[model samples]
Target: GKGSHSNDVGAIQADLPVPSDVLIYYYEVTVKDAGERGVIAVGFADVHFRLSRQPGWEPNSYGYHADDGNKFHNSGKGEEYGPPFVQGDTVGAGIHLENREIFFTKNGKKLGAAFQNVKATLFPTIGLHSQNEHVEINFGAKPFQFDIEGMIAEEREQRQLAVLRSRIPAHACHDIVCSYLKHYGYAETLLSFDQGAYTEQVAKDEETPQAFGLEDRKRVRNMLFEGDVEGVRQLLIGKQPQLAQLQEDPLAVGGSGSGHKGAPGEPFGDAFFHLSVQQFIELLRQDKIGEAVEHARSSLSTFQGRSHQHDQHLQDVLALLAYKSPGQSPVGQFMSTAQREKVADIINTAMLESSATASASGSGSGSGTSAGAGGG
Candidate 1:
């Protein structure tokens, strides 16, 4: 946050854990810098692969060979194993299942790795750690590729959250909701918190799975570049919360950028939570309150910018929360005992008694509700 890009130990260690049984084919990274340069250093800082919790806490081989294969990606090998990485580039490395053969590629060239048979195992997960700044993980592909945009958007939030928590003063009571949402991409919406007067708009439709794929995203992202109001409106109207969350940028904290580029000085859809809560509010308005409530309840579990799975989850939670006999706060009625305690400690004292009573009655294991709403 303070200086030009440099190696961050925390960021490197915060690797995402991939579940077992699934294999990640490639990783796409969006290089960010003064020059938009993409860089992947084999041996030096290409990609880090660690067995989720492999025995003896052993570390897997680096995708590039620091000693044997090639340090700066010598292209003479004619695509033997993996290719070398360069600045401003998004490279892919194959973490082979058998023989643990690691191959590298940059613009589709051959670079090599040091070890083989380094079994790609984890503590029930795989973490695609990028030593470089813009690495993204991709498991499935072709007719059904991974959620690339969502992945990067999410990692960006993680990086930003690390920035926010580290820079801001540590209060006795943390405004984690803001920080959490901020991390989730609601920086601008949260920033709007300071500006007292404004009306919030609800997105009309739920985002479909196909819309999140590469093709649809390409159209949507390009449209923002064209700045077409009607097109943007139609696209955003009624889009799912998950897709909407993708629009928020964690780096932004919010001001006046309203109306796509709303009111002068206002924040753009830079804050992720703005999209999320907007989706949240929509579900509530549609009488699908429980889905949104449950979403907040299992906040940490569902990552922002991944797939519509979490959105579906959000829908269900919001719907369920709506059923709480009115005046029955979603937080009070449906939240887990632990989640209730979390809210109790931070929001209000009255929450304590209500939460306790709700806990005793076990009101959260909601019945009659199929998933997120009045079926919204």
Candidate 2:
């Protein structure tokens, strides 16, 4: 019915049918005029054929009064709440079926939780106790003024993160991955990983082995590839002194390297032996015969009594001292680019394996794992 001032006391209701008791139902009423008495009410009411001048004038109806900003329910009891509205004001009513709560909003701003413990099926209803009162009702055919979907997505994301947190502590995982990425010179990838996985605050808070820093350790490997045997020796002895003893006693390697506690396995005798041979080759290549002889006496002699392969390799390195250019010698493969790469890989493998072990034991020195694994 079209409510009018001529009706004396007019009441109107929408013909649009909505679910009475499932999900959330929201409706808005815009007051075009406050009427001669400034009295307008909008709310929910039962469906059976009973109508009253005001919505809550009947049983099982809940109405929010626009004039006094009060709620009227159960025929008489009224409570002051919400914001009073006049002409050109919009009021919204939302009923949450799951929570059984009724709430109101004024001009898209929530007035607050108004009623709790609500029940029963109802329909959108409006009533006017004075002439000229006019209101328009909208039954959620348009967008909501609030970010309800965004709120739901945020809640879902929080739940997922909570599940991930139950499986792994976020900070510890971030530290491990970041450390591994840094070890391998994956700067751009590490940057993206950090930005996505952690905030600036967390990345800045992590600590590591400063003496054997990833860059410093990687530098030693690079020097071996470049045949800068002296640089590799100084770096290892300074930043990773334990590496020198990696083959000395085997048990001496049992203690932690870089302050990480773990039982060491497989003495890196080959790594040190390769490094020693590379130094001897570089010395001979420099054509400093006297120093080459001294280097062989000091370093190469130690391998003479070891494996037959080691003895043969030592004799080959010493023979390089007699050549004007070792690259043209019969055993020139020793000076080939491939040989340097192989030696670098051997040393890198030793370091990566040691770091992975320490990491598994909870005290990684950040050397990373194998080439395909971690890369330091």
Which candidate number maximizes lDDT?
2
| Cα lDDT tens digits for candidate 2, 1-376 | 3444323446666665457544567778888988777678888776752554576666777888876888878765578887788898888877777677777888868787777887766778887777677787776576656433333333343443344224344588788999999999999999998888677545444322222335654586568767798787666555445555643432244332324234333324566778888877776666667887887777677556666787787787677766777789988888776677677667655554544443333343233312121222
Residue by residue across 1-376, what tens digits does model 1's lDDT show? 2212322111232244333343323343323321222222332121343333111122442434211224222232222343334444444444433334444445434344434554544212222223434444333442223343333443443443344224232231135545665788987877774242212111111221121223333344444333332343344333322223334432221222322221111122232332343344434444665675664555423334534664564454455444544325554333332332222122122212222222222322232211111111
Question: TM-scores across all candidates?
Answer: 0.23, 0.40
Model 1 bad stretches (over 4 Å): 1-10, 13-25, 32-61, 65-84, 109-114, 120-376
Model 2 lowest lDDT segment of ten: 367-376
Please, what's the RMSD in Å of model 2? 26.4
Measured on C-alpha atoms, candidate 2 has an lDDT of 0.64
lDDT of 1 at 61: 27
Tell me the alpha-carbon RMSD of every candidate.
24.1, 26.4
Model 1 quality (TM-score): 0.23
